[model samples]
Target: MGEPLGFNEYSAGKAIVIELKGRFDASVALPVKNRMRSLLDDTPFIIADLGQISFIDSSGLGALLASLRHASRRGGDLRLANMTEKIQQVFALIRLDHVFKIYPDVKSAVQSLKE
Candidate 1:
């Protein structure tokens, strides 16, 4: 088996940072979306830290976009941070970089939500 996907959450003021580790492909996209849905109830500000994400697919990107829409409906936004070069390239290629507010690190992401 491959490395199991993991989530580590951190609270920063009104924003929540969720660190995603391992593959973020089809296998885990549903679960990831479900988890973020529940978290959105607590606060709409969410930051997905992708520094440890080893892989991602279209499903993963869809999950993120869905979560972003959910958050937007709640008058908040979903942010992305700590993306590796490969992940960054993928988002850029897909033009999702314009759809999401991406930061270099979790701290900056959180700070942006404060403003």
Candidate 2:
């Protein structure tokens, strides 16, 4: 198993921010995806704060993509913020940066939703 993941959720403007900590991999992907999916019931717009995430794998990426698709279907979107260097590299290498709207911080992501 990998390092256990932690989540801290809060509301900001019209979006829900889910702060992710620890390693994001197959070990925790299902739970993380489930949490994001469940939160969709409350609101379609979500901001995934990845500042504290130390690592990620393909499964983790899949989870985020799945949640993003779900949000899009509901006429909302999933945004990313506070990404670490490692996360940024992975997303860039995979071209996921073009797929998801990434922001420098959670505040900016929330602001973008208003526009």
Model 1 agreement with the true structure over 5-89: per-residue lDDT tens digits: 8999989978888999998999899999999999999997999999999888889999999999999999989999999998888
lDDT of 1 at 113: 72
Q: How accurate locally is residue 106 in candidate 1, as Cα lDDT from 0 to 100?
A: 91
> Could you give candidate 2's per-residue lDDT for residues 1-115 as a string of tens digits?
4367899999999999999999998999999999999999999999999999999988999999999999999998999999989899989888898999999999999999999
Instruction: Judging by lDDT against the true structure, name the best candidate.
Output: 2
Stretches of candidate 2 off by over 4 Å are none
Model 2 global lDDT (CA atoms, 0 to 1): 0.94
Question: How many clashing pairs in candidate 2?
Answer: 0
